[model samples]
Target: MSLDYLVAQPVLEAERFILRPVRKSDTGLISHYASDERVARMTTSIAHPLPPGAVDAFVARAMAEDRSEDVWVIDGTREGGAELKGIIGLKRMDRNQSEVGYWVAPPFWNTGLASDALQLLVGSNPLKNDTMFASVFQDNPASARVLTHCGFKYLGDAESFSVARDATVPTWTYSRKL
Candidate 1:
């Protein structure tokens, strides 16, 4: 899609969650979820113990880079008010091959927040029909299931460099053919 088109759009919503842009105030809440061992262990990007104020820094970057990452302030709409429950985004958005990635708070896990937001993240947007890919760590079953629920086909294993954790992580590739 064109740059102007993406910028003009507004927040996306699913049945139970709202995917709005991230604000500076969302740092604390992001850190809370991102810091979880269960949450961090699964993803190759996040560092263990989730460095202090790391989430704030990430949010700041997201706001600055409109072309690369469009973050969402995930709120549980069906359950209650706009209390920040998690964050989702179209990270690594290569117009030729964009990717969907997200994290929900531990308290909100097993409730379909990730899947719902993921659907919103890649569904019928500027690049929904195009080929989209996701690299999930082998150990994270929840993440694997999320990809499966989103209709992503298993494309086997691949290796990628993760700057956040400073390692070459093993990632299984999942793809949705548009």
Candidate 2:
């Protein structure tokens, strides 16, 4: 990947938080939340007992000019909330499509932050994608609801490898036409 073909990530705003590109300063907070077993086990990535410097590497990739995915920190400092409430991203795919992924800090769970962030990202559609896709482990229905609430329809049941769980977990796939 090269800078010439990179698409600049845009800052998106919401009533409670703003979605902005990840920065070096976010490493600490991201590490703190992602380190939680409750948070790590739900996603396909983010290994449990996070390896040394994992967050640093993740942040570096996010800031890379030629990265395939666009990641944003769900910042809430504007509303006097936590500066890093969570993280969200869209991984580009062929055919003007992308895969959406996100996770909220355990402390912020049930606070509607995830839902707001998802809605904001979809509404912005920064990648100008024709469609978007997402999948959630069957055990995490909360995430599935967040997607459905934002207009993603259930596509089918599937499985994905979870780095944290170290197993192939059942997942529910969904997609929304833009």
lDDT of 1 by residue, 14-69 (tens): 77767777777778777877887777766667787787767867877777745476
Off-target runs (Cα >4 Å) in candidate 1 are 1-9, 65-67, 77-82, 92-95, 126-129, 161-167
**Which segments of candidate 2 are over 4 A away from where they belong?**
1-7
Residue-level lDDT of model 2, residues 16-121, one tens digit each, is 8899999889999999999999999998999999999999999999989878999999999999999999999999999999999999999899988899999999
**Cα deviation in Å at residue 135, candidate 1?**
1.2
RMSD each, Å: 3.5, 2.2
Candidate maximizing lDDT: 2
lDDT value, candidate 2, whole model: 0.94
For all candidates in order, the CA lDDT equals 0.73, 0.94
Model 2 worst lDDT window (10 residues): 1-10
TM-score of the candidate numbered 2? 0.96
